[model samples]
Target chain A: MLEALLRLPPGPVDLTALDPAATPGLDGGGKTEGKAALAALGDPLADLQERLFAEGRADVGHGRAVLLVLQGMDTSGKGGVLRHTVGLVDPQGVRITSFKAPTDEEREHDFLWRVRRALPEQGYLGVFDRSHYEDVLIARVRALAPVEEIEQRYDEINAFEAEVLGAGTTIVKCMLHISADAQRERLQARLDKPEKHWKFNPGDIDERARWSEYRQAYEIALERTNTEVAPWHVIPSDRKWYRNLAVGTILHDTLARMAPQWPLADFDVEEQKRRLREEVPVR
Target chain B: MLEALLRLPPGPVDLTALDPAATPGLDGGGKTEGKAALAALGDPLADLQERLFAEGRADVGHGRAVLLVLQGMDTSGKGGVLRHTVGLVDPQGVRITSFKAPTDEEREHDFLWRVRRALPEQGYLGVFDRSHYEDVLIARVRALAPVEEIEQRYDEINAFEAEVLGAGTTIVKCMLHISADAQRERLQARLDKPEKHWKFNPGDIDERARWSEYRQAYEIALERTNTEVAPWHVIPSDRKWYRNLAVGTILHDTLARMAPQWPLADFDVEEQKRRLREEVPVR
Candidate 1:
């Protein structure tokens, strides 16, 4: 239910249409109920993750993987989703990459270089805190790249994703949708708390002032890069619990559908058992 | 209390001397009690880890980090400790590396070369599933390397750790000590279960048969390489719950001692607050 509701549809994505405060697919409206629902999903999420990892370890049926790409304006709770949602799985089975502004070395190559290098191996869940979409979103909003270069990235991203899909990597891109009001409150909270002061940046005000421009950039990026295979999920962000629940539900649904089967042993099981018990009996 | 009980002393070590089923430092007996104690430590563990991470992110003081290295024979519950103990922290701040049999490329370089690359950055908790100590353990037992070369590794390892210590990385090494009978049952359980069959390698039986040699190798490795800076702790691993609790307590204690402070804001707080409220007043 959350999967179908949160997964962005084709043709156009307008920021003005969707309410960031709306809880679309969640069963209960209250915070306590929403959190309990998420906690309940933990065991099953862990089970599927272990199966996926077991498949990789034993070279099971499909050499497939999942990539979760998170794109959000500052303080949209990307870290919260990562901590509360993805934390349900065994960390060994998950590969997380946080993309900062490119270093000189990263900038020398095409934007996708670092991203491609960080792709998860088969049977691992790969997460991108911020991904190559930055090339379009921030690059367009700030004019950080040439106009033509920025223009070229949409199709380039699609093509790159197509190649990844062909290689059996399922891409789940989520645009953490937050209201300007939500951002203001969160930024203020950061300012208010001394412990959270490290998270606050003075430049955030400069960006916060240009909220509409960044929102427009996201709409463009969403419209251009959204694909049927790798649909974008617009998670409402005013409520942290709901956002986490929605993303967790979507991921849970995706993995359940994938339903990785445990691989059959390559060696003779009966013979190994005999050898384990008798031939190499306990000393 | 747990740290003192588990920390190996400055002398020759004997595996037969420590009872694998013994639950020292834990107040209550049984699996339920041990698991409860570990669960209680989760919040404090999470808190300390975040502070450590904050220090790294903001370039806070000292720039120190922690590395937990696990060295164990087959079925000593290394995976359990990782899932139950290290899993207590945020996965984002934890860097875990499982060192398998070195590749041909890894062989071309010195063993420590790969170890050096996998070292945790400042303020992160790095866990090695199997580590450089593998070069000493299996390499010595299986005669995979030369006698003279293995003899030199102890001194070389000490020098290498001294350098790592100088750079502010605290090394905590644990040898998950399980009895031969415990390993037999663990191996038998894997053989008995189909879902776990993927984890069973026939070669494990061959290794199991040579249990005494491996124990002797571990003892030598512990004696020769153990230093004041990075002593080896042998956790009795027959009871998986007790093992997890002990390792968790040791890690919680280590991080608490480090007491990483939340980084102070590097910018002007009052001015940012003003700019945040006045210049960009929620549009």
Candidate 2:
């Protein structure tokens, strides 16, 4: 139910319509309950991931894998979601890449080239801290690309997602939606604490100054690129616990639907058992 | 005390002398106590890792990092140590690499080429499931390389590690020591459980048959390459709890010694605070 509520609604993507403070469809009444529910999802979530990993390693049924793309404005709890939600699964089964501003070499290729290289191999739950969507969001807001090129990235991204799906990877694209007011409090908190100092950037204030532009950019990017093949989910992230729970639940349900079976032994099981019982002793 | 005891001692590396089930110098007396002690390490371990990560991010003090190398026979629980011990830290700050047999492309280059590429950046903890020592271990045991070449690799590996230390990574090399008997039980357990079938390899039988040779190779490799800069720790791994606890303690203490400071804010905090409170508000 929460997963359905989180999906980017079927029309123009409107940020103002969603309340960052609202925890619609959440099972719990408050943060304490929400966190407990999140903890509850861990064991089952870890089991599902193990099954999926087993399926990938077996190379069974198209070698299915899941990629969860996390996109959010500054201080919208993307790192928190990664630390809490993705952390539940075995780190061996998960690959996390936090994309920063591109280097000169990365800029030499097509926008998707570096992304293609970073695609999670078979049997992994891949997470992107910020993803290719930045091309449309930051690229548009900052006019880093010409209008036509920026317009073209949406179709390119959809086609890319289709290709990723065709390769048997499920993409869960999430935009952590936070209000400007929430952003202010988070930034203020960072400035107030000495330990949080490393996270603060003066440029963040510059971006905050152009908040409305970034909001419009995100809306247009989501609206144009959101597709049935790989739908975008706008997660209200002002509540860190709710954000993590929503993402974890969606991922858990996705793996369950996959229903990866225990791969039958490629080796002769009885023979291996016999060897273990009788033969495998030399040293 | 355990850290000092576990260190590959000053003379020849002697696998036969170590007890696979021994919880040598473990502060906790038994499994129940060990498990609780390891669990208690969660907060302190997590804090130390965050500091190391912060230092790396700050690019201060030589941009230091820690690399934990895990080496073991099959069924020796390399994956277990990763999941239970390394998993204690934030996944974002930990990079885990599980290396298998090198491909033809990898073989074309020097052995440490792929390894050098996999080193963790400053501000991250790196774990290698199996590492360059495999060049000497299996390569010598199976005669995959000429005897002279395998002998040369020991020197090359030592020099490679010294260079890595010079470049700011503190390497923690651990050999998960499990007896042949322990290996057989683990293999048998895999054969017994259908869910674990994916892990069993018939070829493991082949390797087990050559167990004595592999053990000798490990001794030689460890003897030649053990150095003051990056010494090997032999983790008696028959008991998974002790193995995890030992590895966790070594890594935890290593981080504590690093004592990475929370970096000073690069920008003016007061200026950013004033701006957050007053100026950066439009949308």
Candidate 3:
């Protein structure tokens, strides 16, 4: 079921054909059961993260890392996924980057420049909230750049991700798919609550007006950039519980496949211990 | 009881007066109960962190931050405190910097330059694994600088911390006090385990030989630098569980005093909700 969600086909994609509320990964379970499944993943993810952290800090230099990229429409539960899924692990071993509009210094460089700098170091679980796909998505829809230049970003992103993959970072890109109706309800709820109004942006309504264009932009970007090295998983995210569960499950599977180990020491352990007992004072 | 650990007295201090095995903050509880008490703090810490994060991300610029500095001898359980205490909060709201031996670039700047760069942004909980005090402690003990120069750093650090406090950041400094006998046992244990040998440095033993000098150095540094703006808390750290509990309790108390609030939004909530209901499409 997880594999079915991965964008592996070598053709143009249709966002309209896929159901926005599907939960194929759920085992005929409701929100409670999905949450339970997510909770079950906590120990394993933490254990894997510790091993990865230890490996990265070990004397040897062959350590690896994992990067989880989350891309979605506004109010589509990216924050929910982060709070519920990645929040289970220890913060010491995790690196999270929330990408906002590029700064003046960032704008001076290529799009990938900031993205590359934010990549997780070895032995960490890196999470990106709205990644470089923004270059081709919003940049395409808003005509922030030339159409041909936006077209060039797809291949550029693909090559850059391939380089990262070759350098021992496992990348899992998730596109949280939510219906326009679901987004409307979410936006309404945010506006209804005084404490949540800080999250409600008036400009988000303008972005919603160009929804079809953004969807088309996402479809083309996913079709052009999805590769065996880094596949895009289009997750039905209308149900926040199922979205958290699915993302957690994907990350668990990815770390399991990596199987980072606790590194062995490079010194003569027995001899060192014997010397310490013989020479050092213990009270 | 926690107040007893805070170095609020305005005079010279003696390290010998503090017992490394004391558990002044614990309620006469054993390790099991102390662990449970530490565990109880998880929810409140997480909640405070979320409020801080939300307030920081809001348009208002009045959000404040907390910076916890962990300074102690090697094998004094700084790592344990970090893993057990600060680990309870969301990584998204925390920024940790582990200061190591100075590099060429770091040495080129004033000692506080690297530390200033790593200070947490508003609403974050910043942690320094080993901080700028090393310039006074190790540099004094090892005679890396002239005696007059090393003596001057205590005043410099006090002024630097005063500036940081003025910027709306609460600072807590903790010295993980441990016995030399405990250090020997920890070093031996590290040497006995193959996986732990990487943490064992032969140079540590050389430093251990000059333990009294190091103690004297710490005493002068703490006495001179402890100020109302940033008082040092000398935590008993021979027992790892007690150390974790004491530090966690101190942080919990500090943040509770801060009382970071969930910010009220600046927009008109009812109007925005009505606009969403009328103008937005909902399936």
What does the TM-score come to for chain B in model 1?
0.98
Candidate 2 local distance difference test against the native: 0.89
Q: Per-residue CA lDDT of candidate 1, range A89-203, in tens?
A: 8888888888888999999999999999999888889999999999998899999999999999999999999999899888889889999888888988988898898788888
Task: Give residue B250's error in model 1 in angstroms.
Answer: 0.8
Q: Write the per-residue lDDT of candidate 3 for residues B108-215, one digit (tens) a residue.
A: 988889999989888888999999999998999898878988878999999999999899888989999999989998998888776566578777777887888889
Q: Whose TM-score is greatest here?
A: 2
Off by over 4 Å in 1: A280-283, B281-283
Order of candidate numbers by TM-score, starting with the best:
2, 1, 3
- Minimum summed lDDT over a 10-residue window in model 1 chain A is located at A274-283
Stretch of 10 with least lDDT, candidate 2 chain B? B274-283
Give the winner by DockQ: 2
Model 3 Cα lDDT, one tens digit per residue, A1-283: 5645544466788988878888885658898898888899889987877777778777353648899999999999888877788878877777788888899999999999999999988888899999999999999999988988888999999999999988988999999999998999888888777667768887777798788888999899889988878988888888998888888888888887888776777666676666666775532
| lDDT (C-alpha, whole model) for all candidates | 0.89, 0.89, 0.83
Against the true structure, what is model 2's DockQ? 0.76
